[model samples]
Target: MSLPTLHDLHRPLGSTGLTVSPLGLGTVKLGRDQGVKYPNGFTIPDDQQALQLLAQARELGINLIDTAPAYGRSEERLGPLLRGQRHEWVIVSKVGEEFDNGQSRFDFSAAHTRLSVERSLKRLETDCIELVLVHSDGNDLHILEHEDVYATLERLKQEGKIRGFGFSGKTAAGGVKALEQGDCAMVTYNLNEQGERPVLDYAADHGKAILVKKALASGHVCLSPGVDPVRASFELLFAHPGVSSAIVGTINPVHLAHNVATVAQVLKQR
Candidate 1:
């Protein structure tokens, strides 16, 4: 039998009317190397290398590309690299957070939110982003309730600047609140951490989308001996019917292919 690719497992992104692959390609490593939590140090891939990696990902059936304004030059690089192939991928970006000089800052006021979305569109060279999440500063509930970010995202959706909007929240309550007013929530879920499982349950019950971040625990899952960490991670994620897709940030082509194959295997068994 032929090995399955992510293309074979494309599914609905909540009610946004977009179909996305089961594994999303995260571009953090493609841009920034500072303040990252990965286990080892690495150099950023040049444009040629980055393009080759993207081509490999596409050939392996990945169509969801996750980027963010806080991910260094990620959005800017993707603009030109992904030019002329805009329709081929589902792009997910974020607002409310900015990274500069190896530091991070956030702005969630209505004015900043609107400016962020417009800047993202310009950097991405696209008229509309498929999904935009508010990058939380670990103050999920506070940002959800007091900040104008979510409200502005809703306005952006109505203005046709974004297809869907949600929060990359740090708390279950915030995730639930986000879905109550938005289309999806990016939550942290993996073997080491299940604190956000409630968010997944909520999404399953409510027909909202849940995109998982740090599914491999930021590449820290391989510490256990004799355990297939990749397989283990995917099993834990796919077992939850609410998980729309897991964003895996890997720049190495071999690792990317392995992760996809493992995800394909785990989903097939499900």
Candidate 2:
């Protein structure tokens, strides 16, 4: 079968007016290798390798890139690597979670949110972030209600610092809440887990965007013990019209190409 390219998988990001490829490049592996949940351990790639991967992603026609402050030096590294090619990518970053000394902490106050965004701006070397998600600590409701992060994101959007904002949440209800008030939500959904189906439904019905995090169960899926994991995972994910993209963090250029090919096959089948 002739495979489709990443450009063929491009879709609109809800009402945000941003277009994204169905396969977004996640950069966690590019920065932090400690305290991760990956099935296998890997080394953080050097600048040369990182640049090659970024270039491969663009060549594959990917446009959305996901990163966060809690992802160690992810934003920092992206700053210089993505400098000259900034216009070709839609950058998605987050705030409210900080990783320090191998420990994680949360701070969602408006002041901290502003500071965090400023730091991200400096680290990403971009004047305005295309999308910003609230990096939730799994306490989705409490953070959505009690914290000032969402309000702060709205203020940033108005100030032209961020074009749009949403939540990288842990619960279906939280995703619903965020979309009802914000621009998008990043949820987890794969063969091993389907609890966030309601969130996808909400997005489809409401014309809001939903990005799938852990769409491959963080590389833990083994459906039926025979299926190609990547193909199976994406077949289910892209089957949904609401999913704008799935963020897969891999430093291997070959693996990245395989993923884009699999997503293309799934789209062709659809």
Candidate 3:
């Protein structure tokens, strides 16, 4: 029998009028290799390799693609790679953080936020991004309550440059606060970390989308020998009804397929 794919498991991304696959293809490895926290080092995929991976992802029924300015050349490469298939995916990009010269910097000023979104649009070759998130610098509460980034994102949504806006935050309080004014919150949820469980709970109760980042603990899952880490991770994530999708960044086609199959099995069991 053929393995199940995510195509059949698409669901609503909160009330944003967008439906997303349970697994989102994260494209960081397509653009940058330095400063990443993956357990294993990997060479950035070439144009042909990247194209094939993207094609395989679509065939496996993934519709959400996550990218960010912090991910080096990810946004720019995706522009040409996804040229004609724009409507086929739900694009999630971010503002506030920028990676340059092998270092990271953040800008949450109103002017910088607007500039970042426009630059991402040009780089991604899209007129409007589906979701734009404020990439936090670990100071989630300050960014949400003090910075102009969230408010700027709200304006961008109204101006039709983005369909929805939210926060990729580090704390549960920040996640809940972000959802109070946004459509989604990308939080760290996996077998190793459950501190953000309250964020998932808030999303479930308030009708907000929760996208799981580091779903496999950034490739450092240290579980029991016989316990399948990927399976265990998805089991934890999908058990929560508020999780819209888990963003997994894998450049290897084999890993991608395995992840999809594992998630399919877990969702079926659920």
Candidate closest to the true structure, highest lDDT: 3
**lDDT values, one for every candidate:** 0.93, 0.92, 0.94
Model 2 gets an lDDT of 0.92
Over the stretch 75-183, how does candidate 1's per-residue lDDT look in tens digits? Answer: 9999999988899999999999999999999999999999999999999999999999999998998998898898899999999999999999888888988888899
Over 24-75, each residue of candidate 3 has an lDDT whose tens digit, in order, gives 9999998899999988899999999999999999999999999999999999
Pairs clashing within candidate 1:
none
* Superior by lDDT: candidate 1 or candidate 2: 1
Model 1, residue 220: C-alpha shift (Å): 0.3
Q: Report the lDDT tens digits of candidate 2 across residue range 16-85.
A: 9999999999999988988899999999999999998988889889999999999999999999999889
How many residue pairs clash per model? 0, 0, 0
> What residue runs in model 1 are displaced by over 4 Å at the alpha carbon?
1-3
lDDT of 3: 0.94
Higher lDDT: candidate 1 or 3?
A: 3
Q: In model 1, what is the error at residue 121, expressed in angstroms?
A: 0.5
TM-score of 3: 0.99
lDDT of 2 at 150: 97
List all candidate RMSDs to the true structure.
1.1, 1.3, 0.8
